[model samples]
Target chain A: MTNFVQLILNLLIFPGGLFAVALGLFLMGIDRKIAARLQRRVGPPVYQPFIDLVKLTRKEMVVPGTAHLQAFWLAPLLGFAGMMAAVTLIPIAGVYQGFKYSGDLLVLLYLLALPAIALMIGGSASSSPFGAVGFSREMVMMMSYELPLLVVLVTIALKVGLATGGIATFSLSEIVQFQLENGALLFDYTMLPALLAFLVFIPGNMGVVPFDIPEAETEIVEGPILEYSGTGLALFKLMTSLKMIVVLGLAIALFFPTPLGKNFLVNLLWFFLKCLVLMVIAITIVRTSTGRVRMDQAFKFYLRYPTVLALISLVLTLLQR
Target chain B: MKKLLQKIAKKSPWLYRINAGSCNGCDVELATTACIPRYDVERLGCKYCGSPKHADIVLITGPLTARVKEKVLRLYDEIPDPKVTVAIGVCPISGGVFRDSYAISGPIDNFIPVDVNVPGCPPRPQAIIDGIVEAIKIWETRL
Candidate 1:
């Protein structure tokens, strides 16, 4: 009874549902503001995303006539629910303990792919030609980025596990515990390459400017989401926001789970600060300065650089072990 | 509750453009106002959406030609309810230079309900922006 209630609480209140959504939307607003400023334009207020959400909820939702009704409706919900669950499993050094069990990281690995899968499903089910184009591009992108991501995860697991005298720890909590006991992986010279690889992977996973080919509005007419409007569109927006929190939170947990002090409030603030810095470095500046890469170029770039960087880190870790 | 939602929902008005078959003059002005820093509409919480379904304030450019009238009406129908249409150039409103051409199909307002008209052979950037502001006002009431 207690476990079920706790699980519900974990999914709904503290780290995942409301809190994650709020934080993610806020971050998105900040990103937009910063991007606009960088281009020397006055952007919308930071509460603009919130306003957009309210507007979306109030507007009418239109589904394409020829589309598969069930899949079209359920895709956004699937992504939203998956990200909510994934957030519950990510531990923040002093503030949260995460799901402290073996194979939680592996579970997160699979769960992290759900949004992309949901996008593909939604796009293909919409039955629009643009959606079909988007579906194929998204599938290729998933195949390309998942490699470096897998390598980075395995490299971190081995580096931590070997240092702590084990094979490889798939438990995220244990990885955080190990890092907290020692120093953060951010300061470790050997882990820097892996960190860089993960940083490169961030924009792709988040679907920001340079990596946003699948949903390129100018080219494919918003692609997968072209047919969605109102509440259904709002769900997709909400899903992306939660995804931002999950991805940024995951990066913080994997690379630098260090606490500033014993106070919960101070540490929580510090956690947000780190997330802000990570967002600025990995997402905002990169998105603002770069143009969108062609599908083939992006696929090659991810496969070549990040995958190799992560592989290098893995090889180093294995050699040291 | 409905009133409160409407009040807040007025901020974001996603814009979509349709070329009725005029030349590209008005389209350039629209793009410049939205994309260039000098006349950024994003400050007004306006975005240029790629799809009609995602649009709120529709910007219709060009004069309605005989060939594209059916397509334009179909696209307009796709933009689910409570949408405001802004006829961008003089072409859309009066057919501008192509007033009596066999290819031209009268004025745009003959078919669709135009909420705002920014008139010129191709309206100036300032005029286009003003039309957008008026469209926003009309759009707020609809929301």
Candidate 2:
């Protein structure tokens, strides 16, 4: 009975629903502000995303005549729900231990793919030519990024498991627990390549400027989301913000989840601080500095660099074991 | 709650552009407002959205030439309701230099309800921004 209640709270309150939404929106707002500053311009307030969300919800929603209306409506909700649930899977090292499952890491791996799949579904369902182009590009981008992510997760799992005198572990809580007892993977020389690989994966998964070919507004006109308006667009916006939290939270969990102290508030602030630093380094800087790459080029680039970087860590970890 | 929504909604007006057959001059000016570091329209809580469907504010440029009249009207219709149209430059308002041309079809307000008019051959960035500010005020009442 308590477990059921706890699950509901976890999904709706902390780490997932309300909290994740707020933090994600803030991160996105900060990202935009910093990006504008980099361009030598004054930007909008950090609370601009929240204002945008409120604004979007109050506007009119338009459904295209040719669209698959049911799927079009369901797509954003599907992604929103998936990311909300996925948030509960992240173990906040010194705070929440995450869902206590031996294979939660594997489940998380699958959960991480949901938002992109939801995007592909939404894009194809819109039935616009731009949406079709977006769907194909999104599929290709998802395939390219997933390779490096898989290798990074596996390498971390093996690194932790071997040190603990076992085979590779697929449990995220166990990985964090292992790190807590010893030290963070950040300082470990062997895990550096995997960390770098994960850093490379962040922008691709977040669909930032360089990896935003699928939703290139100038060319594809926001692709799959082109036909969405008002409340529908609001939901997609919410989905992306929540996804920002999930992806950045996952990075914090994986590489450098060292909490400042035993106080819950202190630890939570530390976690957010680390997330901000990571976002600035990996996503904000890269996005601000680069233009969108061609789909083929992005595909080849992801396959070559991050995939190889992660594999190097995996092979080295194996040799150490 | 409705009043509160109206207040914030006014702050998040997203802009989209429709080029009726102008020389790229007006379009370039519109792009400057959207992109140039010196004239950051984003500071006004305005973003240039790619799709008409996602737009809350529409910025129409150029004289509505006869060939592009139907298509521009169709595009304008795609913007969900309660949208404000700001005609940028003299072309969209009076057909400007194209007024007497055989192919010219506007003064765009004749087809679509234009709420604000910024009239210059190509309106200055400051004038365009002022026009947008006026459009947002008009938009707030509808929201």
Best by DockQ: 2
For model 1, residues A1-321, the per-residue Cα lDDT tens digits are 999898899899988888889989999999889888998999889888999999888778888889999999899999889999999998988898999799999999999999998999899989999999999999999999999999999999999999999999999999999998998998988888999999999999988889999999889988898889998889899999998898999999999999988899898889889999999999999999999999999999999999999999999889987
Off by over 4 Å in 1: none
Q: Model 2 off-target regions past 4 Å?
A: B33-35
User: Model 2 over residues A22-114: C-alpha lDDT tens digits?
Assistant: 999999999989988998889888889999998888778888888898899899999899899888899887788898899988888888888
Q: State each candidate's chain A TM-score.
A: 0.99, 0.99
Chain B alone, candidate 2, TM-score of 0.96
lDDT of 2 at A186: 93
Candidate 1 global CA lDDT score: 0.90
Q: Considering summed lDDT, which 10 consecutive residues are worst modelled in model 2 chain A?
A: A55-64
Every candidate's fraction of true contacts kept comes to 0.82, 0.91
Clashing pairs in 2: none
